[model samples]
Target: MKITGYTDRLSVQPGENIKFMVNSHYKTYKAEIVRLIHGDSNPEGPGVKMEKVNADVNKEYNGRRQEIHMGSYIKFDAHPLFATVDSFSLQAMIYPTTPELGTQGILTKWSPAANTGYGLFIDDKGCLALWIGDEKGNVEKISTNQPLIAGCWYFVGGSFDKKSGKIAIFQEAVISKTNGKFSLPYEAEKQNVSNERKVNIQPFADNNAPFLIASVIEKQPDGKHKVINRYNGKIDRPRVACAALSKEEMSAWIDQPSGKDLIAAWDFSAGITKKGFKEIEKIHDISPNKIHGVAVNHPTRAVTGYNWTSEEQNFVHAPEQYGAIHFHDDDMTDAKWDVDFEWKVPDDLKSGVYAAHVHCGDDADHITFFVRPKKGQPTAKTALIIPTASYLAYANNRFQDIPLAQLMFGRAPVVQQEDMYLGEHAEYGLSTYDHHNDGTGVCFSSSLRPILNMRPKYRHNLSPSLWQFNADLHLVDWLTEKGFEFDVITDQDLHFEGAELLNQYKVAITGSHPEYYSGPMLDAVEDFQAQGGRFMYMGSNGFYWVVTFDPENPSLMEVRKNYGNQGWKSKPGEIHLSLTGEQGSIWKHRGRAPQKICGVGYMAEGFEVSSYYRRTEESGAPELAWIFEGIAKDEKLGDFGLVGGGAAGLELDIYDEELGTPSHAVILASSEGHTSVYMPVAEELYFNIPGLSGEENPRVRADMVFYHTPNGGAVFSTASIAYCGSLSHNNYDNNISRLTENVLKNFLLDQPLPGAEKQQVLTKN
Candidate 1:
């Protein structure tokens, strides 16, 4: 009950055994975790040994150090072992058995050797023995035969009535089962009266003796009970029946049925006719069909099934022998029909779909099923529905796809220009959509309004008529070469409900100058990609602003910018507007960054682009030589504008270098001139910054990145938009022609085209 070194008070019920958990010093002998009891105390009558409470000498130390004889001021070194809340109730109760000596030395006495055993005896034979404390301490013994036995155990329990002596002891002997079954108790067990053995009727005499506890195995640290006689010269008796029960016995007591608390064991309906059946409410089919009869096989190795349907079902199948799900009758076996033997689709199932059928018997009538080899899958089929605006220009056309006209002319409030011609005096062109036609029509004039107003901030240089035409042309050519298909309608061309479009197309393609998009168009594409659709950008300043168009109004889309509209922060007219916010933003608005977003913003760095390095065997250039099948390794990365420092004709330049790409994505090629941009908020800001933030900016790493859907459909992107139109603008067939063919074949056409050869792994010392 006495506590020390703890702030929290301990509590226990009446009659509960008290345990003092103390942190004491260690002595000469390596201290083992122990449980102690006073076995022998000095100068008393017959003394009992002090048993070890709990000690562990298992800890490895340098040496035993030194040893000391009895009473030589033992300095036991100790460490504090923190006690948990549950450790308080772990100590066992103690019963004293020391002072019942009868001067006969039969009931309690010291050993003749003076430093040895005290134990229990039966039929003039020692049955159990115990020693505690130091060699100089006293020992106790019990030399009576009634309670001690050689090969038998006596279980003492209670029977409240006194007629049969109130206390009952069943002397049941242990017997082992010869067969692998339960061991039954031995018969002919004896029962004896308490008065059979003569002991003076001293009702208050202490007869409990100390028991020695040590590990049954000499090498291990364990505890056992050894009973010792306190009276008979410390007769050593290392015997006490083991009372430990198996887990089943403890569970029986814990889960036994009770009458007072009578919880119905038969809570379930005994049968369908049971009154307890509360109209078994219709159970909905919550389990998916893919998991219906599936048995897990090698759960670690992911095999594609229903979960991988999106990645174009390109996952590898199991070996023929292990292919459990057999759809054909030729391969069906008794094992195949066994529902107990269905293959377990791994949680990490690869991206693809799997199908298998089983016919229980040799009849045509059978069950057919399918599994998508993916974990989380869309309920709807994945497909791509090209928007009406894109349909006009491309429509699978390589020569004259009208991606620009499809985007602009299809909407209301058509753009207008003056009717004018270049080259000759007689040449003239018609100004179709303009309200007031002037002599300025038919001139190829580029304005900075669209670029400036489309900025996410700074609205001063705003102009309605920006270089929309140029943006349109670039998008159209890029789309055509990439082989994207589209519908050719003005406004009401392409629209759908929910995330349906994403399920069809693996990727949704857009343009740089997609500065204007109707609300519905934006929502559709956003939902599409969010549902796992891949998206590619070919033009600059795409998804720049927010516009709402009403068919009822019959006017141009209402362009909202500044801090006025609800979505002004994302509106295109605000200047440098972005398409996406964060990584997963529905729009994922990003923008031009001469220094931050794009390494090269505005027209400043456009003029400095020049090709440097050529293909070299050491650089793994020849490995991708197939990508340039008709070109040599010595060729430049690409040929575009001449090397200069002034305002270049193009906004982006392509060269050769290395850039990091996502594991799931591929880097087809890279360029050195392309700089990297810095945008700390690109992750949290949920928007792309436009224009150069400052001179201290990171350069863009020009790379042609490729991303494929789970089903193997893909989208490709180049660092620069200048290569949008010409396959060989400067008689440079290697760069433009090779890239265009690769993009078109792999992405839009879904062709089984050749890819770069795997690079060899080199080991260095």
Candidate 2:
């Protein structure tokens, strides 16, 4: 995999130092900072471009190798009982994901500070391996007979005896069904492999606090301990006994009740709540000594365990079945690279997108960051708040398996370099749309890692076309082309500063898919609107699913997808987001659908073809003629352009009074001639019935809505993701362009729109 990097802060001001981190396979590399000019792939449109900003930002660093331990494992605080142990027995259930990587740490008490400890891990040869290194670095290592296959559950463990001076380790396959339905693949049956090694009867590593699992601590020469050799795979209940157990005793412990020999046993599936899961920061112990451990990177919790029967999906109800932690070798939250260089934005720099462009031989990459005008400064009347949370949710996503993906695209997507990189590097991490090794869907995502798909020219794996960040760039390109001055504030900015961050701008624009929102973010938008701040929900599916972020842990974002308008459902009791204690799923389920603000909420979606919007009778009314000024009454708005070659297609929304569409809201236009594949949203249906398809359902279309809030605040929604992509077509002279220009002209004016004053009267009526 090629090296990539990201900044800690999305948008930075001059005098603020932003950390720059890189993940590289090579040691020698160069870096520099550049301003991003444009991020589009359309050969006909503005091509890939950038501008250099600083010479001091350019430098070189010999990037150190940092191993990302992917598998989730637990560690207990050291007690006199655990620390004094000389010989002990350890056992765990392992489902190897990458047995070929070799030397996967299953459990260990090894820390490099003391350079001593014992551990049970899978060897590089994919064999059950046991290693015991003493204080002097003297070691005894041994492995099992045959190779262990990947994705199969096995019972691998060992026992060390001080009196006998022998270390015994064995690897035996668990032939039974794993998730109650998944059985191990047929492998050649051979005698169980148990190896014994005679070692010096020295006390185990005396380091009192070096105990860990999945990784070993290597004390750097600089006196800092670095965690290394992280194992990649799933690790189940790992138990440690104070002393060695006989083979027969071990056999009994495997299928029978593990007796008092267990000094400490960790059940990785103990705590997650429906009321809120944020309280589950520590895993509760089941052993007599309750030395619970905290989960790092929150490794894929609520996953299926070896005991899962496939009968219960909720981990809360069947905790035993959800005891596994799946890990990967490439799960990076931050590259943590030594900063080759850092810069505070100069005060005079414009509020736009910028990046640190790094060149390493033939390979080149960019570490992007956004710049906002000085705090409290309004350089422009309008601000475009990027849906960065939604970007995080779909970051580095793999949607090729979704049945709708290919069917919606019509043809196979043209794979980009980022797509191929993602496919080859599954260790980079999974999107919220994906599932863990145990089959439970993934919900939490973090931006501390390299998200290749978030870059310019990045294309969707299934759609080939630009999506989220890249697709949003189409609108960015439009605003720049039209010479409209606007400050760029990200969803992160809205989350931190809340309403105050948006109050300065007369109006705020949203990129296409604002699918993820936190309570504060939603409140900020609503409060800004309630106070007369105009909102331009420029795309469909705005304010959709709920998400959570902790300022304490800014790099991590969490979501619990359950109960609405999505592909995968969260486990029942786990529907509440653990990060913010808020209920997940769609915002509509929370009684705050997008329609309440913009008069349009998600309705349906089809990717094959984008159709045009027909002007409603409401649009032609003399008072409302301004929105359609200079356009023929019979003209089909946005009939030909970029995305799907029209304005509405990929995903559409509708105006519905029952769903809280404002009573005085004017639906100026509605898209028509949609294909059958565009089906209504899941929440819109009470039952699976026929004719819920695009052509049959009246609501399967986008609504062009304009509504005035109190204090001159207004909301105009295009209600389609494909809307902005059409703006640059025909050299920006098309009907879509004209209509948008007209709206912007009216929206940018200093007073309430003349027609909207009448709507206010109608609202009071």
Q: Which candidate achieves the best lDDT against the true structure?
A: 2
lDDT of 1: 0.24
Candidate 1 per-residue lDDT, tens place, 213-275, comes to 111101112232211221211111111111222223222322232222111111111111211
What are the runs in model 1 whose C-alpha is more than 4 Å off? 1-467, 474-509, 516-536, 551-555, 562-628, 631-635, 641-663, 670-696, 700-702, 728-734, 748-765
Candidate 2 residue runs with Cα over 4 Å from true position = 1-3, 23-32, 58-69, 74-83, 87-106, 110-117, 120-203, 206-210, 214-294, 301-332, 360-362, 400-405, 564-567, 686-692, 695-697
RMSD of each: 37.1, 5.6
TM-score of each: 0.28, 0.80
lDDT (C-alpha, whole model) for all candidates:
0.24, 0.74
Worst 10 residues of 2 by lDDT: 179-188
- Candidate 2 per-residue lDDT, tens place, 550-649, comes to 6667767778787666658864345655554456788898999888867899888776678899988888788777778888989988887566778887
TM-score of 1: 0.28
